[model samples]
Target: MNATVLKFGGSSFRHTEDYHRVAGHIADRLATGEGKIVAVVSAMSGITDNLKEVMLNVNKKASPSNVDAALATGEMISACCLEAAISRLRIPVMSLNGYSLGIRTNSDFGRASIESVDPKQIMAALLEHDVIVAAGAQAIDQSGRLTFLGRNSSDLTAIVIASMLGEHACEIYSDVPGVYTADPYLVPGAQLIPELAYQTILQMSLHGAKVLHHRGVHYAEKHRVSIICKSLTSDGAITGTIVSGHGNARSVTVARDSPVFSCASLEECDSLCALLARHDINVLRLEDSHGVRVCIVSDIDFAQRLVSLADIGPVFIGLSNVVTELDSSGLLVHLVGDYDGAISLVRQIHEQMYPAVVSVPFGASV
Candidate 1:
């Protein structure tokens, strides 16, 4: 009836030593009188990609079902490895795949949608095992074939389990300490968002913030399950970022690493927008430069789609080799929360917290 879920991404288990370190974290948590904790783990880093390559080499014409099975081996392997590592720490731990934990999905193979989870079985397992290590991403269909839940589904996996048990929050441990205003690498002065609204993070995630999956955040928002994003590669007691429904409503900016398609006219823009929308690809932003219009190609799928639309190359600023001429100079600024009033003009922008922090060197700590 009560539990805490810990979700670890592939980056956390990059090596055998990493597994040992993760186990140490788990063991320490259990020691702190945390009754029952469930760990939803992803495949080790590079393991999933390597497994997909194996499938490609062995069978060029492999079925979607086979690909699903191959892709799942990474998480399955991770769960087992963690189980072993934790057991060595003198803790009782058990590894369970999505199916074993009652995670059911639709028959979508590489892009499965979780339909339901058997809470009875999950509860029974928690009663018997000190730690339940559930494999993330991959689940079984109605016909019982292993299927993956798209990219970053491990976070979804943990959220689902936590929601099933009515837990308020799930702790997602990753390499990054917490979500930031922008990619720290790009904006070196970017500040860590101490707390954020779920909707804010969801938009950030959708607009190419690699902190967590949008679907995962959607599930959390719908189920009222908050998420805490922290770093596994950090020192003691890092609280990280708490993503919930309550936060200051302000325009949050996030940048993405992608290109844009500049349309010459409003007619060209309308057609291009409609086409990409039909394919379910989101255009991050649109800029009107005098008589010309530009559509930022933030979504990777949209970029791929441009390759076959060479016939309409001229429509997009007379560029036939559209994909070849990727404009990496542009970055996306995703806005979160709501704001009223129409903008008179669009000029310059600023990173998260401002260019206004005056420190009084001679004053007392304030």
Candidate 2:
């Protein structure tokens, strides 16, 4: 059962035509003697956010289970669309969603953790079809209810699928060619990294690099799976960086605006922090002139819900990014006033870190 696992991020499918483009790529791979192909796809660009917005706008108090069900539709639609495109090419293809994917998770709806994976279904599907499109970042709980993995979590789904299916490596395609010293889109001086250690990328993700999900990297390390990051272009697929057991480098990461909750006292802050931690939410504690504050860096919506459930009134701070320099020494975090400032700091940090390489521009040649 030799199969090639590939994941196409939301950026890959910005419109309906993009699906056809990707389908063509898959067909070409199959035609080129690539055996079984398993493609994990995310929702079309901004589709997930659009769906989430509509769901929450109508029912602000929607249960986690219900929200998961609504949010998973984006990827489901993507899977089906891709399947249709592949079918149009007269290729034997099929699409599977959370229900049929055979990956089971706990009842932690918003950020469900995988409990087990039964690859028989996927294997059987692959045996019948040339390409199998699996909806990313979704699974079913013990009760068979739909559960979303998390925001920007399609990477995790792809890695898990590759590992469970006995595949040693998985290729992830996104807007960028590969991991860079900083986000290439924002930092023009950012240079593409050819390779990286699992631990290094994991730390980058943990501190706020968007190249890969931290949880996914953790799972890949445990399963000894190598992640090949690439970008799909009109010319074809271009390999960028490979994440495995070796390589080292310094990078800068800028996190999105995190929800900050002001706690009255230190005890209250610690208690709230522990509760969030138990739920697997990441938080950072801070002491300021006002009092104690807990910054929710993981999933802001889920964190807000938990805070409300705990009967705590969260003080909403304006959007801000926490920029950090990642290296062997330690993390040097800087609190940026805004996203612009964060990008500026990232450029400064990246320039200072790799001054000689700042002139290089990333492209297919890399």
Candidate 3:
């Protein structure tokens, strides 16, 4: 079964005309006799924020699970609305929630990872409908409990879906034209980059580039899936950024650039590492300063769970863009990322805040 997954960001449905345009584009793709299409979409623009606001207002002491349940409604609404719009155009389409489509996640309420995906249900659904509109970022656990990914993780939803579909490439449609040499908002005259290596794109995301998140890129790279990042409002030719994956290197020994979580003590660090080790999680010490403990890990789920542990103090999360320090209360105490005239967190790909473009050739050197 030949199929492709198309993901639309929240910006694509910000306005009324945008919904029509996106639906029309999907219709156009189907008109040409392409195979089945699965379109993944985020919540409508401003809807997620509005929903979050509602959650904050309804109950300040709400649990993370409750908050996730509330926030997920935004994507659900977007998917249903888009499905309606497409169906009105005389196209066969149906909206399906992640849980109904056989997406299962871990118990993490607000930031869950896909544990398993049964694509049989999705394939059968697609066979009945020309397009399957999936509500991204929210899935169910094994016990039939609702869980969510993270903020702005619709990209994760898309890539995971593509991986399950066994597709080579999935298209991510957003408002940004494409990946640029530098952040256009930060550096004036920055131009587009047509292609990028998967490793480079992962670095860009880990470093603070908002165009794509590292989790999605990491999953795609692991599954040998390519991602095409393009604009939702483009016309004529399809000029976008292509992130290509590479096979396992038999001879190339690459440095480990995973982000680390630092604590204030040794006993705490050792115990934390020991506990994580049982789960097949490895922690690598990267730096030492004044008896400080710094260990690198793959993801932040460990840090999130360590919030209540009294052993660690002031857990610092190092991201590509910012270093977030979580207080003992698990709240964001302070954020430090890219600073002007100063060196930010260093990564294997880019050492400075102003990222050096080594992934693709200069498409537009303005």
For every candidate, C-alpha RMSD to the true structure in Å = 7.9, 1.9, 7.4
Candidate 3 ranges beyond 4 A from true positions: 234-237, 246-263, 266-311, 315-366
- Of candidate 1, the 10-residue stretch with the lowest lDDT total is 338-347
Local accuracy by lDDT, each model? 0.70, 0.88, 0.68
- lDDT score for candidate 1 against the true structure: 0.70
TM-score of each: 0.76, 0.95, 0.75
**lDDT score of residue 26 within candidate 1:** 86
Worst window of 10 by summed lDDT in candidate 2: 357-366
Residue 138 lDDT (model 3):
86
**Candidate 2 stretches greater than 4 Å from native:** 311-314, 360-366
Error of 3 at 250 (Å): 24
lDDT of 2 by residue, 209-265 (tens): 887888899899999999999999999999989999998788998888877777877
Candidate 3 weakest ten by summed lDDT: 247-256
* Comparing 1 and 2 on lDDT, the stronger one: 2
Q: How many backbone clashes does candidate 2 have?
A: 0
User: What is the overall TM-score of model 1 with all chains considered together?
Assistant: 0.76
